[model samples]
Target chain A: MPSILGFGACLPPRVVTHEELAERLGVEPGWILEACGIRERRWAQEETVVDLAEGAAREALSAGGLRPGDLGAIILGTGTPQRQFPGVSAELQRRLGCPGIPAFDVHLASSGGMVALCLARELCRAYGPVLAVGAERMSDIVQRDFVKETAILFGDGAGAAVVSPAEGPLEILEALWAADGDFASDLCLDSGGPLKMNGRTVIMQANRKLVATVETLLARAGRRTGEVDLFVFHQANLNLLRQVARTLGVEASKVPITLHRYGNTSAASVLIAAAEAWKEGRFHFGSLGLLAAFGAGFSWGGMLVEAR
Target chain B: MNTLDDIRALVAALAQAPLPEDPEASLFEAGVIDSFGVMDLVAQLEARFALKVPDEDMLPRKFESLSKIAAYVASRKA
Candidate 1:
C-alpha cells in the first residue's frame, strides 16, 4: 500500500477580523456568520501561492528524510495560481530544484488537495515517491467589494504530503469523490475576479452532499461511523462540519477543525488539519482518519487513511 | 447583563435572520447559523456581558442550540 511519508502545512499568518468586514460591507458580522461559517480567515501578505507551496513542500521533504531530487513528480491542487503560464507546479519544482521532474497541476477548486492525494497515491503505486501539494493565495484573487464573504471563508496557505509505497497502517484505503454541477452556483466566484457565493444555497447543498459522501466512503471501507478514529474534512463553515457529523451519527469530538483559526484554505484545508492533528499526537496505530472536502467545482470527496 | 437571560437577549439581537421553529434543534442542524455567525454571537456576548471568550470556548456545541448558548454563558458567569 502507498503510505504518507510526511506532511506539512503553511499559513500566511495575517488574520482579518469580522469587525473589519462588517465595517466595510455595512452589515453586522453576525449576518455574514449566520449565512456562512466564517469569522476570521487568513490572508497572504507578500506571499505567492507558489511561495507557500514551496515552503510547505520543503518541510515535508525534510521531514521525510528526502530531498527535492528524490521526488519523482509534483502534483499541486489549487484554484488560484500565480499565472496561467509556467504553472504553479513547475514553479515549485524549479524553486525546490527538482528540474525535469513530472510536475503538473490539478484544478478541483476546494477539493483539490484531496484529489491531489488520490492522484499521488496512484503515482506512488506506479512509481515510488511523489509530492502532492495544495496551495492557494486566495487573498490575491478575492475582490475588495466581496471581502466580507471571501475574506471570512478563505485563508491563504499551502499543505503538502509525500506519498510512497510502504508498509504501515497509514495506507490510503480509498477516496470517494462526488459532485453536483447543478449546485455549482451555490458557491462560486463567478466573476473570475473575486469570491462570490449564494450563502443560503451553499448551506443547503453542503448539508446534503457532505453527508452522502461520508456514507458512501464509510460503506466502501466497510467501517462504521464510530469506528473511524478521527474526522478531518474541509473547513468551509462550522455548520457543515457539525451537520456531517450529526448526519453520519459520529461523535463531534472525533472531528478536527481549524476553521476558527485558519478559516478555509481551499485545497489546503484537509491537509492542514491532518498535519496539525499528527503534530498534536492525535493519531495512533490503526486510528482511522477520514479526509473530505467540497467547494467551487461543487466537487467533494473523502479518503479513509488508516494510521500506522 | 451577566445572566443567561442576557445571553439569550443578545442571541435575539444578533440574529439577523429568523429563529428556528424548534429552539431545541441544533442551530447547526436547523441550518440557522454557521461559524462566522457563531463568532458574531460570541463577539456580542463578550460586548454585552463583558466576558472574555477564550479560543477554546468557540465550538459548535456551545452555540449548537439557544439553550446550549444560554448554558455556556450562565456557567461562565457562575
Candidate 2:
C-alpha cells in the first residue's frame, strides 16, 4: 500500500471577506455566509497555479525527508491552469527541478485531489516517490454573477502530498470512485471565462454522492465508521459538509473543514483541508482517516487511509 | 389520500416546523426548511405519493410555499 509520506498546503496572501465580495456583487455579506457558510477566502493576487503548486510541493518534499531528485512522478489536479498548454504540473516539475519524471494533470474539478491521490498510489510502486498536487487559481475563474452564485463561493490555494511505497505515517488502504456525467451541466466553467453553477443541484448531487462513496469505501475497507478517526471532506460548502456529516452519523469534531475560511478552492480544497489537519497533529499513529470529495463531473470519490 | 393535508404533514415532518399561516409564504424565507429539507421532502413525497419529481423541478421555487409545494405535488400526482 502506498502511504502519504507527508503533506503540505500553500494558501495565498490575499484574503477576501464576504463583505468585500458582497459589495462587489451588490448582495449582503451576511446573506452570503448564510447561503454558503463561507466567511472569507484566500485569493492569489500574484501567484500562478504553478507557483502555489511548487510551494506546496517543496514543503511536502521537505516534510517527507525526500528531495526533488527522489521524485519519480508528479500528478497535479486543477481546474484553473495558468495556461492551456503543457499543464501546470510540468511547470511545477520544472520548478521542483525534477523535469524528467512523468507529470500530468487531472481535471476532475473538486474531486481532483482524491482522484490524483488514488492515482498516485498506483504510480508509487513503479515510480516510488510520487507527488500528487491540487492547485487552482479559482479567483481567476469566477465572475460577479449573483444569480450563478459563483462569486462568493471560491478562493485560491494549493496542496500537495508526497506518496511513497516505503514506510510512512499513513498507508492508503482503499479507494472508490463513481461518476454520473448527466449532471455535468449542473456545474461547469465554459471556455468563455466565468464560472457557472446551479447551486441547488450541485449541493444535492455532491452531498448525496459524498455520503454514498464514504459508506461504500468504508464497507469495502471492512472498517466501521467508528474505526475512522477523521473525515477530511472537500471544502465545497460548509452547510453541505455539515449535512453530509450528519448523514454519515459522524460527529462534527471528526470532520476538518476549511471551507469557512478558504471557501471552495476547487481541486485544492480536499488536500488543503487534509494538510491543515495533518499540521494540527490530527493524525495519530495507527489511526484511520477517511477522505471524500465530490465535484464538477458529478464525480465523487473516497479513500481510506491508516496512519502507521 | 388528501394531497394538501398529506403535504402539510410531510412539511411538518421534514422541516420539523409548522408551515406558515400564509400558504403562499416562502418556506425558505420563513426559515422553515433549507435545501436538504426540501430534498428529503421531495423523496418522501415521491415514495409516499408514488410520483416522480423531475430534476429540473427540484428548485426551491417549486416548493417555495405550502401552496406551491401542494400544487407541485398535486400536479405530479395527477
Candidate 3:
C-alpha cells in the first residue's frame, strides 16, 4: 500500500479583502462573500509559478526525509503555469537536481491535484517515491476590472505531498472520475483574457456531478457517506460546497473549508486544506477521508482513503 | 488629509508604482494595481484617511484612476 509520506504548502504574503474588490466592482461585499465564501485570498508578489512550486516541493520533500534526487517521479498540477513552454515540473526537476526521473504536468483544471495523486499511487507500484505538487499564480493572469467572479474565487498558492509505499495514516482507497462535455462551457477562461464564469450554470453542474461522483466512489470503496470521518472537497465556491454537502448528506462540520480564508487555488485547494487538517490534529488513525473536486473541464472526481 | 491628493498619496505609497504627477493615472488597466494590492491600499486608506472601504466598494472605478480614488476617499472624509 502507498500513503502520503509528507505534506507542505506555501502561500503568498498578501491578502485581498472583500471590501477592496467591492469598491472597484460597484457591488456590495455581500455579493462576493455570499456567492464565493471568500473573505481573503493569497497573492504572490513578483514571484513566478515555478517559484511557488519549488518552495512547496522542497518543504514536502524535506519532510519526507528524502532528497530531490531520491524522488522516482514528480507530478505537478496547475491551471496557471509560469510559461507556456518547459512546464513547471521540468523546472522543478532541475532545481531539485532529480536527474532523469519521470517529471511532467497534469492540467485537470481544479481537480488536477487529486487526479495527479491517484496517478502517482498507481505508478508507486513501479516507482517507489513520488513528489506531487500543485502550484498556481492566478493573480497575475486575472484582470482587475473583470474580477467580480475571478478575484473573489481565486488566490495564489502551492501545495506538495510526498507519496511512497507505506502502511500508514493515509492511503488512497479509490478514485472515481467522470466528465460531461455539455457542461464544459459552464466555467471557462476561453475569452482569451480574464476569467469568464457562468456562476449559476457552474454551481448547478457542480452540485449535480459532484454528488454522483462521490456516491460512486463511496460505493466502490464499500462505504457509505456516514462512514467517512472527513470530507475534503474542491473549494470551487461557497455555494457549491454548501449545496454539495447538503446533497451528499455530509455534515458541514465534517468537511474542511479553506475557501473562507484561502479562497480557491484550483488544484491546490484540497491538498492545502488536507495538509492544514492533518496539522491541526483533525485526522486519526483508521479514519476515513473523502476527497472530491470539480472544475473547467466539466470534470469531477472523488477519492476514498483510510488514515493509517 | 481629506483632500483628493491625500488619497492619491496613500494609493501611490501602498501600490509602490509610478502614477502621473497630475493625478489622472489609471490604476486598473495601467497595471498599477491588482486584487491583492487593493487590500493593502484599502488598509492604508483606512488608516491614513480615517475612512472605511466596505466590500461593496471594491470596484475598479473606485481605484481605476488616481483622481477617482482620491475623490472617493475625500468624500468619505467629508
Candidate 4:
C-alpha cells in the first residue's frame, strides 16, 4: 500500500472576516454565521493558484525528507486552474525544478483532492514517490453581488501530500468513487460567469450520496463505521458536516473540520483539513481514518485509510 | 405509527438547538433550520414516513415550521 509520508498546507495571509464580508455585501454578520458556520476565510490576494500549490508542495517535500527531483510525478487537483492551455501540474513541475517528471491535473470539482490521492496511489506502484496537491483560488471567480451564497462560502488555499511505498503512520487501504449527472447543473460555474448553486438541491443530494458512499466504502473494507477513528469530510459547510456525522452516528469530535476558519476551499478543503490535523498530532499508529468528499459533477467518493 | 409529536421531537433533535415553541414560526427566519438542516429533515421524514417527497414539494413553505412539516407528512401518509 502507498503510505502518506508527509502532509502540508498553505493558506494565504489575508483573512476576510464575516463582518467584513457582511459589510461589503450589506448583510448582517450574524446571518453569515448562521447560514454557514464560517467565521473567516483566507484570500489569495496576490498569489495565484500555482504560487499556493508550490508553497504547499515544498513544505510536503521538506517534511517527507525528499527533494523535488526525488518525486516521480505531480498530480494537481484543482477546479480553479491557473491557465486553460497547460495543466497546473506541468507548471508546478517546472516551478519545483523537476521539469521532466510526469504531471497532470484532475478536475473533479471539490472531490478533486481525494481523486488525486487515489491516482497518486496507482502512480506509486510504478514510481518512487508522487506528490498530490489540491489548490484553489476561489476568490478569483466568485461574484459577490451575483452569487452571494457561494461568494461567502469559498476561500483560497492549497494542500499537498507525499505518497510513496514506505513505512508511515497513514497507509492507503481502499478508495471508491461515484458520480451522478442528474444533479450536475445544481452546482456549476459557466464561462465568464460567477459560481451559481441551488443550495437546497446540492445539500440534499450531497448528504444522501455522501452517507451512502461512506457506508459502502466501510462495508467493502470489512470495517464498521464505529471502528473508524477519524472522519475527514469535504469542508463544504459546517452544517452539512454536522448533519452527515449525526446521520452516520459518528461523534462530532471525531470529524476534523476546517470550514469555520478556511470556509470552503473547494478541491483543497479535505487535504487542508487532513494536513492540519496531522500537524496537530491527531493521527497515531493503528488509527483508522476515512476521507470523503462531494462536489459539482455530482461527484463523490470515500477512501479508507489506516495508520501503520 | 409515528405521530405528530414524534415528528416534532425529531425536528428538535435534528435542529440540535432549541426551536421556538410556536409551530407556525418560520424555522428559516428563526435560524432553527438552514438549507442543510432541511436536507436532513427531508431524509428523516422519508425514512420515518416511507414516502418520497417530490422535488416540487421541497419548498420553504412546506418545511417552514414544525406544524407544517408534520402536516405535510400526514398528508403524504393519507
Best by lDDT: 4
Each candidate's DockQ? 0.03, 0.32, 0.02, 0.32
What's model 1's TM-score? Answer: 0.76
The positional error of residue A22 in candidate 4, measured at the CA in angstroms, is 1.7
**Distance from true location, Cα of A87 in model 4, Å:** 1.1
Which segments of candidate 2 are over 4 A away from where they belong? A143-148, B1-4, B15-34, B42-78
Give RMSD (Å) of candidate 1 vs. truth. Answer: 11.1
Consecutive 10-residue window with the lowest summed lDDT within model 2 chain A = A141-150
Worst 10 contiguous positions by lDDT, candidate 1 chain A: A143-152
Give the residue spans of candidate 1 off by over 4 A. A26-39, A190-192, B1-78
Off by over 4 Å in 3: B1-78
Which lDDT tens digits does candidate 3 get at residues A1-308?
Answer: 78777777888888888888788779998898876668888888877788888888888877677788778999998888767767789998998898888999987668777777777787766877889888887776665446575766788888888888765468878877766676566566653466766554465456666777788888998889899999888887776677678767788899888988888888888778877877776778879988788877777777788877
Error of 3 at A245 (Å): 1.2
lDDT of 1 by residue, A2-37 (tens): 888778888887778766767877888788677665
Error of 3 at A70 (Å): 2.1
Clashing pairs in 2: none
Error of 2 at A223 (Å): 0.9
Candidate fnat values, all: 0.00, 0.28, 0.00, 0.40
Q: Please, what's the RMSD in Å of model 2? A: 3.8
